[model samples]
Target: MRLGAHISTAGGAYRAFARAREATCDSFLIFTKSNRQWAAKPFTDDDIAFYKDAVAEHADLHPVSVHAAYLINVASPDAALWEKSYLALREEVERAGALGVDFITFHPGSYMTSSEQEGLDAVTRAMRRLLDETADTAPNTVVCLETMAGQGTNLGGRFEHLAYVLANAGPSNRLGVCFDTCHVFAAGYDIRTPEAYAATMMEFDRVVGLDRIRCFHFNDSKHGLGEGKDRHDHIGRGQIGLSGFANFVNDPRWADFAAHLETPPTEDGEDGTTIDMNQVNLAALRGLLASSSA
Candidate 1:
């Protein structure tokens, strides 16, 4: 797989490229705007030009993606919240398209007060509308439904949930999946051993098809298996050790895929100073790759 991390776009979206390069990323994920906000300042003509130029200069950082704002929850039964989420997601798609990103991944949404079937149906309708409305604008960007940890009433804890949306959202080239390691492990899919990994993947293929996976969030789970939590820890330092990661890094089927690290940074110096842990975590992952080859 092409290893990378979620690079922060703090100063400007264009600056993310430099930060990614600093961490030696082969690809990367970014938030086009503030992930916690509903509104953002419009991108100016100069901003667009500089972003495109930075992408050109860093030609090696291929297959970049944008994670949609966390506030979107299209599965809500409430009419107002549903409409807001649909619009927010639609805007996110347009923004990702404008940036020429390959994919836009998002949490599938929570059922909250509704039934699982109701939530599934709502998400399907929203996805259908999103694809139809953005066909022209987001022609090259695929909407990836992320696997969740099943915290509270969230959907997508099972592969079947994702399959429901993909199967019912009508046939479109703009739909896919982003498999999150921490979420899946916390959701009960084991990958700590070779046999367990093979079984879990077999189940995924049966339910969602391996071809639908376009991106990955390579995080380690802080909680144990089936804990249904979303805590992220450093690679190989949490519940999922290096052995679990080895199965993923060595999988030939995903050799060309973009696997991004979303792990937290660590403190490396005295006086509680923090360090960029992307380099550290990515190095550990690379070590797994090297050992497998050896």
Candidate 2:
């Protein structure tokens, strides 16, 4: 697997590549805009050029992904909110295309008191609309729907839910999946042991099909199995712990997938509290894999 993290694009889109490099990442994830807000600053030609140049210089870094804003919820029952979500996502797709990113990962929305079938249908329709609108642009940039935490009325927490969305998407190659470790653990897919991990992944292959998995958000869970909570802890520090990540990083099936750390930045002077945690996680994971091979 190409190891990396979600790096900040504070200066410009291209600057994120430098940040990823500093973190010793072979791949990275970035947001095109402030994730909390509905509005985003328009991209300039310079932004596009800079991003293209940076990516070209980093040819060894494969599978760079763009994470969609948190505010979007395609399954929203509120029509206005759903429209806003669609437009925002559309803009993100265009921006990602300009930057030449391979995939854009987004969360499938919550139902908000709507029936499960209704919510799934709404998400499917919205996704189809997105594909139609952007048909002429960014054909290579696949939109990856992330699995949710199953909190409240959220959809896509189940592997079958993601499979449903993919199957409903028809023949479009623009759709894919981004699996989050914390979310899946919270949604009750056990990864704490090698046997359990194999079982869980086999079930995913049987349901969602591994071919659809494009990216992974590598976070440890602070909550236990079946907790339905979405708290993320640093690698090896949380409930899922080091063994869980060991299983994840050692898996050959994910060799081509972009594995990114979304853990919070560590504070100054605190032990293990730095962005270098990405490097630390990578080293630890490598050590584990080496021992297992022995």
Per-prediction count of colliding residue pairs?
0, 0
Q: Candidate 2, which segments miss by more than 4 Å at Cα?
A: 270-275, 291-294
Clashing pairs in 1: none
Prediction 2 global C-alpha lDDT = 0.86
Error of 2 at 160 (Å): 1.5
TM-score of each: 0.97, 0.95
Per-residue CA lDDT of model 2 for 145-172, tens digit only, reads 9988899999988998899989997767
Q: Residue 168 of candidate 2: its Cα lDDT?
A: 93
Candidate 1 clash total? 0
